[model samples]
Target: MQGAQRNSLRLLQWMMAASLALPIALFVFTSTISYTSTKDIADREIERTLDVAHEHALKVFETIDRSLAELNEVVRGLPDEIIRSREPALHRRLKRLTDALPQLKSAWIFDANGKSLVNSLASPPQDLSFADRDYFYAHVDQNIGTFVGAALTPRPPYQGARFFGMSRRRETDDGSFIGVIQASVLPEYFESFYARIGSDPGSFFAMGRTDGVVLTHFPRLDRDFRLDPTGPVGQQIAAHPEHGLITIAWPSDGIERRVGYRRVAEYPIYVSAGLETSAIRARWLATMGQHLVFGIPATALLFLLLALAFRRTQHLHAEATARREAEEALKHSQRLEALGQLTGGVAHDFNNLLTVIRASVDLLNRPQLSEERRQRYINAIADAVARAAKLTSQLLAFARRQTLKPEVFDVGERMQSLHDMLATLLGPAIEIGIRLPAQPCLVKADAGQFETALINMATNARDAMQGKGRITFAVQAAATIPDTLVHVSGSHDLAGGDGLVSVAVSDTGIGIPAARLGRIFEPFFTTKQVGQGTGLGLSQVFGFARQSGGEVTVESEVGQGSTFSLYLPRVPTDLLPQRQAPNTAPAVAGSGMSVLLVEDNIELANFAADGLTELGYSITLVDNATDALAELTMDAERFDVVFSDVVMPGMTGLDLAQAIRDRGIRVPIVLTTGYSQALSQDGAAGFDLVQKPYSIEELSRVLHRAARLRPVRDGAAE
Candidate 1:
């Protein structure tokens, strides 16, 4: 099932990836095609505009050519003197023709000797010499049919606008060149027509001679200019003399454009129309933007749907995984339940023995008993009870049900204080060594439990060496547990918070077998001869380490030695100073010190009330926290201290204590329980706590401490 789910997840991921990639690929392909198409349209439009300019230029040139031919015919055989005499009639005819053609500025007739004979501008025109003019010299020599000249301003007194000359050679019947009949073509004529046609912005129309001499241009220049004969446009004109298209920058302005050129038929002039490349691209972008405006959202919506499908597939995969884990957990729990039942039965039998011993001890307290025998019985009973309590405490710790009172303390300081005690326990035969780090290593946990775990490991080490080997306790700050150590039982995730503090207890003794390490943490599992070891020591260490958010690890080599290391979450040393546990001595209940005792167990409550009453505490007994809270509510000052059990049905002691305080009652609260997960996890909520099966002296001390914390009133202690 897992393999199939994984395959399905992979398939969904691929589908989602393809869903996004395919649309982007298609959008890019379409955009590319659109760009090429738009450019083609732009190219064709430029060609068409060029053709229009060509036709307009052709008709104007043809009319000018025809007029020039007519003038040449009229003067075909006439001498200069005869033509000069008929100047008035000729001038009137030329004026009429010039007036009819808006493009014509003026017409002139020049003698071969470079003298102006008769001209259209004025009848009996000014006798300006044509010797220096280029048009007269061209006709005077070889016949260059319809010679077009470079752009020139008319001489002063005859100036209207810039124009270029178009001329035809005049000759007698012998076909020898006599003079020239020339027409002045106005540049503004084409520029005005170009404006009326409404061409795109930055586009231009131009007319030029074949030799790269610019004749006229729309959007005319401030000064006269010529095209480079070697440039792209000029080269195209030479290569494709009739017509062609080219994309090139205008030499005059360097603005790149798509230009189309046409050579005017039977004339030396060429006309071109151009559209700027920037403008063409603008058109293409506008089209592509429209496509994106619609296409992008559609693609995004498709992606969103695919994302939803992928999320659903992931959820299904998680459900399958959870089902598998649940089945495995159920099986594991069944195994744990079997083990728990065995342990519970043993604990039950042990408790019955303790009860019988306790009743016997109570009966022996009769008044008629002899002093010597009674003292001996009293000492024996005390020893047996202490041993039983310690055994039960070990069992609870191994089960992780002990109600721990955790506090922050310096590990190095605590370890230092244990040196003398450890020396006394191990005897002079076993050498003891203590190692500490230079810096203080602080940890938050039950300081008493931590010491007990250390002492348990040390005692085991002592027994392994038969009471004649060295034992070393090393404390230091650690980043993580060493991987080389065997993780017997407990969490392996020991590195957390600020880091970890490791307390390693090493022994020079016969090491434990590798096969036995795994089962060492099990309750009641032992390696020594019968009755020599309880096997609950390492188990208690394991439970304490796990409950403290840490772990215990061991490293050993058979016949050599073993090292047991305890790892606990480190507290920042700079955090508020370690709280010092106050020195507690056996306390006697004060006279008139009223305590509200809340307990659900009837027999236990009665025993506690009687015990405390004998110690001079005015005890008020209640079965549950509700009644205790009600008693406090009715008379807030009735009890100097509210002593309650932490674990109870309906309302827990912790809740009742909070309730009494929440109601503005100043009674001090002291809690007791065999084991409360609530107290272990979040502590006693600032209330004093006492462990179950506590002695009257211990109970009195806790109650006295709590009562002292009550608010003083009337300038006296409450």
Candidate 2:
């Protein structure tokens, strides 16, 4: 429970973090959008203010410029006498001109000597030399076109007042130097016009020239006409082009603003407008706070809900995993119980066979034994040994490790051979049925495993029927089908279609349950009482069928009994030609052919040696293949045949046989083994082979055949 809670908490933490993070990210995005939109709106408002300021400032300059032009034209016709005399008409014209132009403070003319000829506002002092003025030198030297001068203080009547001048040069008819016609406007005129636009509450406007000269500026500076380019506002304007918006602190006032400036066309004046920088930033901050107010709480609520859902899901998954593990543990315990039952059954069967052999040996040990009694004792021991071999073979088959010797044989023939054995195994009470197809069901597999599997199925059928029902062992060729486990629902011809060979053992007795049918082939799974069955009979059948490249299937209903079918893959008819069973008749004689008998067991060696001598063969005995090889090496031509027993300790009999041939010795060689593995391809190669526990007659025949056979040539049978 502690582990579960910890995992739940970890999952909830991650989920909550994800949910909250999403909304916070959205909040950031909303703030960014608001900041962008606010900046754009502020820029548009500033641009509009600049437009209005530019129009009014341009209008004021145009009005002043027009009046100057009109004055220049009117004074052009004045003859030489008007300048010589202090004329009343000129005086009246200058005073009336000053009264008509609202912005103009003075209108005057100056002669070639730089003396004031007449004044618009009042009379000027005769001793005042205007030559020192830059405007005077400007008109005297270049005597053409109108010139607008820098702001300056007027002398005498207009004293202590600053104004910017506009002047036109007066020339003779020959284009020679004459006099100047000039007008001036008070700086108050531009300042009053700038104050009216109201672009921003704390905005400033200025008029300047590119040459660092200031005509006039609103909110006036204390400096002279030469504007300071080194100042912040001045530096910003100088670095930019005619008209653009820039953020700069006004050096004259130290107020930061977004300023817009434009140069007037064909005039010495540049007009600039600006708005306070603090106002724009303040408006943007207000918008961002509105988004944050609603967003944070809603995000937290969503994160809590997601964390709860994740914690619930984790609890369900933990319960499901624990349930599955418990089921597997129960299965393991059941299998262990079955294993104990199987071992006890095997021990009981072997003990019975050992008891019979022991009883037979005791009877054979009496000194005065009759011939018929001696034969009976010998027969009992032989029968017990055969039963032991069968028991061990079945156990190996159940384990699926038995060596399989495959051969092409008719299934019908094999079933016919098991007729008497199956009848005796099932007892007299249970009747048997044998079925075979008209055509042969030829297959390649281990014949011994196949026969054992058949007997095992018969025994199982007898048990299912309580030893009183009919048992049928049938052989038939199956129809072509993709799946190995085929359901036979219709009739199939045995001769026409070539497919698998199926051998089925069926019973007309109590049927198996559908649940039990699937598990009948599993080792130690039986319905019988524990001591009555080892449960390996059906398992042996299953292992044999599969290991031989075949399949086993069961079909049953509640009361219709069961049919267990073993399906083996069919072989090509000509792959292995059928061989007739060799005659097991006793050998009549040996033609005195020399034989070297290599047998490891002392009792078996003496028996074989005595038997071979009686059969008239020259016999020699050795305990092992190593000693046999040494004996042959001392006199290579002494033995005509090397009969070695397979499966010795140091060197196997097959190894000795191969070594003799490797040295090019031409004597015939044969091998024998008690185990099935010795009959495999490697053991049976380049020599004749015979199974163990052979009779004296059987050994004699094999030895005679080995000596008669031609020597092996080039590692192959001749």
Candidate 3:
């Protein structure tokens, strides 16, 4: 009886093992099948989205091209007298053509002297000059029949609107150029076309011009969404004009999305469509859920049957315990990871607030606070604010929250600026050396962030050396590595081509240990004393480099020093000239006649009104557009300029300007905002824009200069 029981127990154990193993094996197979099927579906969907977006983009190009061609034909048919004449009949005929063509916002015939001859809209008296216009020169010099001008917000004829001009040279029967017939298409037409192209819910579609500025987008387009072709997405599109798609998992939302892009051949524009991966996985999840629903009951039934048939089942409990422990470990690691990310985000936002407060406080004592005792107290407060701001900036750097405004700048120039400060920081015990090329070796990065990173690294080096060491800063063009060459360091080989810049910072100190090197970039993982380091220096540098579309790598050994190399992508030659120092405020101006002030911030508005009044300009203050329009209708000529905030309660500043223009009120409109680039193109166009948090000097200058100007016809309109 005992022998029989032992054999039966062994058999029961084997049967129980198979039961658990079979379901797990089947689960793996099902998951693989589901993943493969889902990926296939996603690929097909992405391709379809790209195809639809491209088709819509092409249609826009064709519609504009055809409309311009028709306008050119009409101009060709007209006699030279009729074309050059500003007769009401001629204007009526052109107006009819413009009205008949829905896409054509306005049609005009301009003689060689750039005067509006038979404009579809109101004809301004002055003879316009086209010699300066890009489209005009392209038609005149290059003799390109169909010249499409850049996206322009039409100023005059149809003020406070956005349009792009399409021009064609009008030739006489003798084949000699007589004049240029131009048609303007409203951007709304393009925007509408994109909207009709159809988009998935929770998905976004965007079209970017050749310059990397977003032309249109489904839903709303944020100010920062504009084409910055040098950005990561822009660079990808530029480099790969063919079918390209990228999948990114948003860390903030925990949502994955796939962005698929295709270039439209007719124009230098790329149409992109995105689909949320979570949405795509919904069906798969549902199916899996159903499977699990059935699986649970089936699994329970199998367990009950085994317990009834077998006298003992000790092995099952041991296996279950092991699985639970493994799961627990994974959960623990994930919790830690999440906590770190949350800490970083909090640090970043706090830093930005500190920066604003510090800057504001510092500005308070600028006009000589050194004399008065109270002024000295205020200065002390400002100093404390500055220190707090610096601490926040460091936290933000560690958290990767600070905004990076990058531009192409010479590494040598940047290094030179920091040399003295770095030397002072290191003390007499350490030596600092910089080796940079005489010629500008430009890298695209935010100067402030880069400087901060360098200083942090230098500080780390100082600490490692125990306040004595030699630090070297060097920059050069990265060596071109052939595609076929094998790299032993596991680093991605730098692509061979022009326009690559590299920055290297090396320190002669007790180097990092091999074991600790990998952990160096982990926040709060410091080797220093509790009070000495927050353990975020290397991490900040890593984040800054990565955010700038660059890579940072370290080379170190136990005894030798450490070398950190930053590889930043090069700016194109054409873009290099456009690069300038980032300015906090607009250049200041001195005097003006009359001004309209629209600000919701009561204190800021009062301050501005006082400042403008002091600057010899009469100021009309209104809280919102309703009051401004009521005032404007009462006396349009009373105001020389319209100064308004962008984000107001009821009618936006743009809407108010549009309303004023609709009522035939023409004045130089200046729009100001704390978040300057956040305004849409339609809202920002036609008026001069000034970013806010402005000094009195900046506000005065903008108003004075803008007030001095009268409404002039845009060259592109002609």
Most TM-score-accurate candidate = 2
- The digit string of per-residue lDDT tens for model 2 on 1-718 reads 5477668768777778878777778777876888788768767876776677677657766776676677666667676556547546676788887887667888778777777787766554355668777666788866656577888887764464688777777777777777777788777777777777754555667777766687777666787655477865567667875777777876656778777777776666677766677766677777766666666667767876786677676676566567756766877776776667567767787888889999989999989999999999899888988877776766666665555667889899889888998878889999989989897778988888888788888889898898898988888887653354433322233232347888888898788886666567766678899579768788888777766666777777777888888888887677667578978677848678789999899998899889889989999898988888888778867676788888788888888988888887778888877664544434367577666567778888888877778454445544
TM-score of 2: 0.58
Better of 2 and 3 by lDDT: 2
Report the error of model 3 at residue 704, Å: 5.0
Tell me the spans in candidate 1 whose CA falls farther than 4 Å from its real position: 1-15, 22-338, 341-385, 395-401, 407-445, 466-469, 476-501, 513-519, 528-530, 548-550, 568-589, 714-718
Best by lDDT: 1
Candidate 2 lDDT score relative to the true structure = 0.75
Lowest-lDDT window of 10 residues in candidate 3?
Answer: 481-490
- Using TM-score as the measure, what is the rank order of every candidate, best first? 2, 1, 3
lDDT of 1 at 33: 97
Per-structure clash totals for the candidates? 0, 0, 4
lDDT of 3: 0.69
- TM-score (all chains, Cα) for each model: 0.56, 0.58, 0.40
lDDT, candidate 3, residue 458? 86
Tens-place lDDT per residue, model 3, 17-39, is 77777887897799779867976
Lowest summed lDDT over 10 consecutive residues: which window, candidate 1? 341-350
Question: On a 0 to 100 scale, what is the lDDT of residue 193 in model 2?
Answer: 74
Candidate 3 wrongly placed segments (more than 4 Å) = 1-370, 384-406, 479-497, 513-540, 572-694, 698-718
Clashing pairs in 3: 212-227, 213-227, 214-227, 589-701
